[model samples]
Target: MCFYDEMKGYHWDSVESEIMNRSRDDVEKALTSSSMNLDGLMSLVSPAAEPYLEEMAQRAHQVTQQRFGRVISLFAPLYLSNECTNSCVYCGFNMTNRIDRLTLTAEEALVEARAIRRLGFQHILLVSGEAPHLVTLPYLTSVVDLLRPLFPSISIEIYPMDTSSYEELIKHGVDGLIVYQESYNEDVYKQCHPRGRKSDFHWRLETPDRGGNAGFRRIGLGALLGLANWRVEAFFLALHAQYLLRHFWKSFITISFPRLRPAAGAFEPPCPVSDVQFVQLLAALRLLFPDAGLILSTRESPYLRDHLIPLGITSMSAGSRTEPGGYAHETHAEAQFAVADERPPEIVAEVIRSKGYEAVWKDWDAAFLH
Candidate 1:
């Protein structure tokens, strides 16, 4: 069954109550358990687990070291367009917003790709607002065809497509797919995305399954924190990840924790997650899925990003530009969101080295599988 159907078996209220009712003994049991499961994840993120933060961090660190070693894979986001059809209230690219829209041509995207290539990024993620007309498959495939020779690893974070569409892109050297559910709560999801194609919650929820069937090499999943109670959201996200991992055993699953940030509409996170809670959630995810990647992006501050490296983050996006044509051109286009860590790629790599971790530019090549 698809995750939406699997999700129906568990009631949200019941899960939240169980998490809140966890005791210190439950937290200890989770920490000492040989194999971590969904039940262990509950104890690790509970209020009772707050007092065991240090212990959780220590265990998360050791699991990460054993599973991934001391390396952090780094990539940069190459925004292709800011033309969105969605009216997501929390996003800067909401269709109702009066921001300038831009979509890069193949040549223009190559210019940005070359700029990112010079910055030493062998892995690239193509980003755009959810406007299918502007960011059509023909347009995306053309851009990927032009960029395939430059970067070995290319991923896309755009509108969801059918399995055939994802398969076609994979044939053109696009091997990874990243989709954020925004919020796992169906009610909050509907309220936040009031209009556009993104409003179809079940369609979006089943996207990774399509990508998996298309044989994507990597599948990334996350819920935008702060939309609902974080503990509830995290639980659903973990459930989603667990479902994907079991069905799509061939694809590597990565999880991202993107806390809501300030954008054009000035929407505030109704349920803000504090630093301690964020750490707890991250470490809890690490213990639950030790081999799955934990990605930290520039939405966070530099100081916090630096400190979060050892916790369980296996990948990061460095020197990211969140708007179209940001790298090669000097456009005054408004960004999707303000970058909290504006340091260049070199400086970010330097900091990773100081933390005794190797900053990897490229870890996979299509040639290896062939």
Candidate 2:
């Protein structure tokens, strides 16, 4: 049975409403209190919590420095294919998009991996559109088998799969999985993903559950910020993260805040999240979950990334190419969105060093997992 079937009776909308209705006092209590629990997290994301941004930032910085020190983990994305079966309206790789689709063979994948590694990226995020027939478990496993010897850590941001499939990948050296809910608003989600496998909201919602069950070392969660009310969706994401943390304490958790970028077939954001608001949300997340990993992608400008690095961001993707076969084979292919920070990975590392932070290329060793 699907994991969502078990959680079907539980209502997420009611909890989201409760969080949105939080008061100033609750926000203050959450900010000042030592042991800020799940309720505290709700208040931090509430609208009334705007006034405590500075305080939250201060605590976030301290907590971040204390836990992670003056270090920033760096990684880059490798888009293997653009052939998708899903029709997610907000993405350029959607099946409906009329663009060139490319899937890398094992040799092609190695060529791209070598190019990425040459730039000193030891952590790689393997990405592909949702096409199970083309990007099946065996295909992905083969890619992992080839890249595992090159990169120390590898994570996937692809279509959702069953627990057994995830287990198979994990055994083949997949370190982590990042599966965003896009938005927690069920109606909006359904509207955004009109057809194909992506329309099944409950299945997408339960992806992390499946990952946890498969014994993944880490699972990343987030809502695409601009798609819905950042506050409400973030609250649900935090709740989901909290639930996973409580139930699967062994699995490390990370959160990414990817504001929507202009894609091939664009859709206007219902709720546009500003830079300041995004910072506030990041600070609040840090204050709430001090030990959790916060990631910023190349979608933000270099200036914004520099400012955010010290605040709470622990990991970042630099010089990302979102298009399929974007690195080695084709650079002018269709991209999911235009990357803001177009600087190369080495330049990004220089910026990190300028800020008195070490850019970590490899933190995890393959033997450690064994």
Candidate 3:
């Protein structure tokens, strides 16, 4: 059954009460438990656990080290296009935004890909705006055909597609999929995406299931932190992730925490997550899902990201450019979001090494797929 079916069985009242009314004792019990469950995770992520940040960090660090080791997977985002049809209120690519747009030709994409390869990132995440006509399956397949031979692992972070579309992508060499629900709260979700195909929340929610059925090796889920109450959004994200883990056991799951950043929309966040709470949330997620990958993107500031590395983050984006043709061309499209950590990939790798963690670029390969 899908998570929406489970949502029908749950009452938001109990969930809000469980999180908002959690006591220090509840937090303590969750942290001290020999093994974690949903109840423990709820308590740990609650505000009651704020005071025990150090303890949570220590436990989370231990759990992560036990499962994965002192290694950070490094990757870069290759923006394929910024020509969007969706009117997402929070995104820079909203159709109403007056900005220069770009849809990279296959040659331009290769130019950008070759530059990224020189930066030593063999794993490239191909990103695009949610314009069905502009970024169609055939278009994506051609892009994959152009870069699959150069990059060891290629992933997508574009509009969601059906199982058949994803299967076609897998056939052409797309190795992973990252589809953020944007917000799990249906009311808030509809409010944010008022126009275009993205208005269909249920279809977007089922994209990962479609990806799993298409046999993608890895699938990612996330909620934009500012869309709803961060705590509630995170709780539901954990629930969604756990469901996928149980059902799609073969796919490696990763969760990304993308906080609000400056975009073309220039919309202010209703509730911004503080550095302290961000750390606490990351640690709680790590403790609860020890084997799951926690990704910290360049959206966070350098100081905050530096402190967060060992806390629970397993993967990170370095030297990222959020605009189409951003890396290769000087006259590129406006960025969807400005990157906070401007450090080049080499500098980021050195930082990882200085912390005694190995920087991994290609631990995955297509050879095993056959």
Candidate 4:
């Protein structure tokens, strides 16, 4: 069964009750447990856990060090195109927007890839607006084949597709697949993606499952926080991650927390998660799933990102450009969203080193695929 099947039994209303009702005693009891369960996770995400920030962070840091060591895996996002058909209200690439659109040819993408490589990013995530007709499977295959020789890790944060398409991408050397649910609240999700194939919420929800079935070694999951109550979104997100872990045991499942950032649409996160609460949520996830990888992006501020590295963030992006063909071009197209941390790769790496941690640019070699 797809994750949707497993998820269908639960609803947001019920989950909201469990998390919101967690009391201070619940948080204390959950934190004291030697091994955390889903209830423990819910307690950690509770508002009651806010005052226990220091205790949570201390435990989260210890858990991370034990599981991942003092290493920060690094990567970059290379936006291939900003041409999208979806009318996602929170995005700059919404179809109704009046902006210049461009999809790079394979040659142009190579130039961008080489530029990214120069910045010491061996891992690259190719991003595009959901314009499948413009960014077809064959188009993506050629681009992946081109960069397969340059970068060791190539991930995609684009439109979702069937298992066959994911298998095809793997054949051409794409290993990492990152897809966000945007919001787990079904009603809000439908309203957020009013039109286009993205409007099919279950299909988007099952994307990582499809990717896992197609044998992707790394399958990334996340929620676009701010769409609904972060606690509600995070509970379902943790549930999804847990489901993937149980069913797809061989796959390395990753979780990312992409809070809403400003875009051309002037949209805002309805229930904005404060920085302290965001940190609390991260610590909760770390404590609950000690082995899972947590990825942070340039969507966060430099000060916050730096503060968060030691807390529980295992991987991060630096010197990221969210526009199509942004790396090589001086005049870039409109960005999907404005980036918060704009430090270059070297500087970010320097900052990581200053914390007495190693910033790793490359973690996977193709030989491991065997």
After superposition, which runs of candidate 3 have C-alpha atoms over 4 Å from their true positions? none
Q: Give per-residue CA lDDT, model 3, range 1-370, as digits (tens).
A: 7767765665655786779899999999887778988888788878998999899999888888889999999999999899887898989889899999999988899999999999999889999998888788998999899988888899999998999999999999998999999988888899999988899999999899899999988999898988777887778888888888988999999999999987877888887888888887898889878988899899988888877878878989999999988887987588888899999999999988888899999878866653
Task: For each candidate in the order shown, give its overall lDDT on alpha carbons.
Answer: 0.93, 0.87, 0.88, 0.91
User: Which tens-of-lDDT digit does each residue in 265-334 have in candidate 2?
Assistant: 8777778999878988898888878899999999999889988888999999998988877778845568
Candidates' TM-scores? Answer: 0.99, 0.95, 0.98, 0.98
**Cα TM-score of candidate 1:** 0.99
Q: Return the clash pairs for model 4, or none.
A: none
Model 2 residue 281 lDDT score:
89
Query: Candidate 3: deviation at residue 316, Å?
Result: 0.8
Residue-level error in angstroms, candidate 2, position 358: 1.0
Q: Count the backbone clashes (under 3 Å) in each candidate.
A: 0, 0, 0, 0
Model 4 root mean square deviation, Cα atoms: 0.9
lDDT of 3: 0.88
lDDT of 1 by residue, 1-370 (tens): 7899999988888998999999999999988888999999999989999999998999899999999999999999999998999999889899999988899988999999999999999999999999898899999999999998899899999999999999999989998999999888889999999999999999999999999999999999998988888888888899999999899998999999998899998999999999999999999999999999999999999999999999999999999999898998988677888899999999999999999999999998967433
